[model samples]
Target: MPRSIDSFNRQRLITSYFSVTLSITLVLFLLGFFCFLVLSTQKIANHFKEQVAVTILIKDNAKSADIAQLQKTLSVAAFVKSLQFISKEEAAEKFSKDIGEDFVTFIGTNPLQNAIDLSLKAEYAEPEKLGEIKRELEQNSFVSEVIYDQSLVALIHENVNRIGLITLVFSALFTFVSVLLINASIRLSIYSKRFIIKTMQLVGATRSFIRRPFIRLNVRLGILSAFIAMLLFSLSLWGIVKSYPEFSILVDAWILLWVFLGILVMGILISWGSTYFATQRFLNLKTNALYY
Candidate 1:
């Protein structure tokens, strides 16, 4: 080959490799960011679940001993995240303070009901589970009607699901676009070596043998691209931490590892897909097509 032709091919291959690497990086970065958002939302959901406080009310005539026993039972229940025993006097005082009004004028006697304010862990903090818990508590002889803000709980559940669906939709759209870009880059990368592919085919190279070098190159490209993508993701997270210092708590090393792994896997899959299609196209070309 002429020196100029060799130099041109060398530059083309280099450029093609870089293009594939950059495209894979872009795709993985998008995917990683999407994963991060999902994980962050899940963390927020956990915090929300932890804050869902459950209030259990007892009958006015219930014995103190029975209420204590109930509290103890709840404290050990599988669904109970935590339990706080609110005595009648304490509840009344809290209500009075919350309202910022004295009940002394309206009440001839203390009509305050005994109650136990329970706070569940994040895992058990769903509407259906909460309803079941409330039902169980109400079945107790010492317990009166269980009072909880049902509307608020329902609203929260509905919003959480709605937000989750929106996130999924956005992620899917982004993923579709990324797949096309990455595949196109990989295909173009392989296409640049089409003449060499034709030479190998004319020499009776099996499809697998012809694809071996590309696959090997692709594997390396996948790793390199994944690292690049991970670096970008880490930078994004660092930006986030800089903007909101509080986010550092959730941005731990394990989460970063998950992002790295996800990026690497995405890179490998996309590279493999691109190589497969490119090789198939080249192999199917007529002998005269090589001159083109």
Candidate 2:
């Protein structure tokens, strides 16, 4: 009878520990995922921003040498991500293909002007910055006009800001919920061993001594749970990269390393703190209070 009861209690203890570790792992994974989203928000925004192009129209009478000089100047500009020079002939050909008719033949002349299609870096894809760039380019002697989709630029900027704010709010709320969940799991795991805590205290065990073993065990649980969470997080990232290969550019090794380290630290701190406090509560309870 004694051996059977011992076996049952041991199995229950193992089950309890497993449950606590799994709970903590899941919570940590969610927290890590939110952190990754917050960090990658800017990178995702920049990818969209760089897709819009600004067109610089060239004067019809501009000399080849002057056009070449202008191209060189724009190539070296801080705001320019990339630029492509389109000749009048090439532009007219592309337009004709788009409209499925030879407009140049109907007009008896190629009416399209030579232009440079400019792709600005993500940071400069703002209304104010684009306006400044347009004004700057229009001042050049060989440039006739500089134009881009101002409405599109404004829309992208607005949407990116809105999404970033929403993501930040969600991340903060999720972090708070994660902490509470991990704390509760740790407290329940300790609650199952309250009698052991009180028994040791009754047998002349000091408070610090009683806490030391629980703290050490919970810390180890935290480390193990953190590793498992990191593994799940990494698998999720791998799945994302596999589905949308373009997003692979946003995955920075250094940033991911820091995020994983943060997760590990959070797990350790929360577990240790929870275990310490939970054990302290039981230690403070009187002998009669142990039943309730």
Candidate 3:
């Protein structure tokens, strides 16, 4: 009976060790998911920013050289995220296609004006800031006018702001819930080890000496789980880019780097915090409580 009891205890310990590891892995996964969500949101916001167009109407007789120069200048503008030039011929063709049935015949010539299509950065997408940017662009001598949907831009900016706020709230909520779950998991995992902690304390073991191995184990678990989560995120991103090639920019090096670093930080922080609290609770228990 004594030998059978010993085997049972041994099996229980091994099972609990794995259960704790799995819990930590889950927490790390959640953290990475949240990081990816944030990065995706920012990319979506940039899509909106790139869609806020400002048309730069050129003079009827503006030379090709002047238009080329204007394009170069607009490309370098602080507010501009993207710029494209539309020649009179292309504009006329587009208008005719939209109107249908040879509207070009009534005009006899391409009466459509040449223009530069400008997409502003998100920072300048705000209605008031955009108006100021438009006014600045209009000051150029070759620019006949700058035109875009003022109300539409305003609406986009407002919607983006609301989305940003909602994302922040959701992230906070996820974090809170994740932390609580981690704490519970760690407590359960460490509960079985309480007797050992009390025995060490009775034997005059230093707290640092007791904590070092556990902390190291927690750190290793954090790193491995975080790497796995990041790998999954990368795979998901690659699949998305493959399916929708137009959004290739979302999988750019900079964005991927940001996501990787964010996941690592989140994993390390949450794991370390959960382990610390779990160990603290164990150390604080009354000696008699360990037997329970």
Instruction: State the lDDT of candidate 3 residue by residue for 1-292, as single tens digits.
Output: 9999999999997787667667766666666667666767777877777787888999897788888987888788888888888988888888778888566688677667899888788788788988898888788777899999988887877887788788878888987887787678767777767788777877999877776677777667677767877777777777988999987765657766877887678667777877777787788888877777
The clash count of every prediction, one per candidate, is: 0, 0, 0
Q: Compare candidates 1 and 3 on lDDT and give the better one.
A: 1
C-alpha RMSD of each candidate structure in angstroms: 3.5, 1.6, 3.1
Query: Could you give candidate 1's per-residue lDDT for residues 1-292 as a string of tens digits?
Result: 6999999978987887888888788788888899777666777667666777777778878887898788788789887777887777887788889999767446856787777878777667788988888887788887877877778777777888888888878888887887788888877777778888988988989999999889889878988998998888888889988999978767867677876887788788877887888888989999688567
Candidate 2 weakest lDDT stretch, 10 residues: 246-255
The order by descending TM-score is 2, 3, 1
Q: Please estimate how well model 3 matches the true structure, expressed as its whole-model Cα lDDT.
A: 0.77
Tell me the TM-score of each prediction against the true structure.
0.81, 0.94, 0.82
> Whole-model lDDT, candidate 1?
0.81
Instruction: State which candidate has the highest TM-score.
Output: 2
TM-score of 1: 0.81
* Cα deviation of 46, candidate 2, in Å: 1.0
Q: Model 2: runs farther than 4 Å from truth? A: none
The parts of candidate 1 lying over 4 Å away from their true place are 1-11, 38-43, 59-62, 88-114, 245-257, 290-292
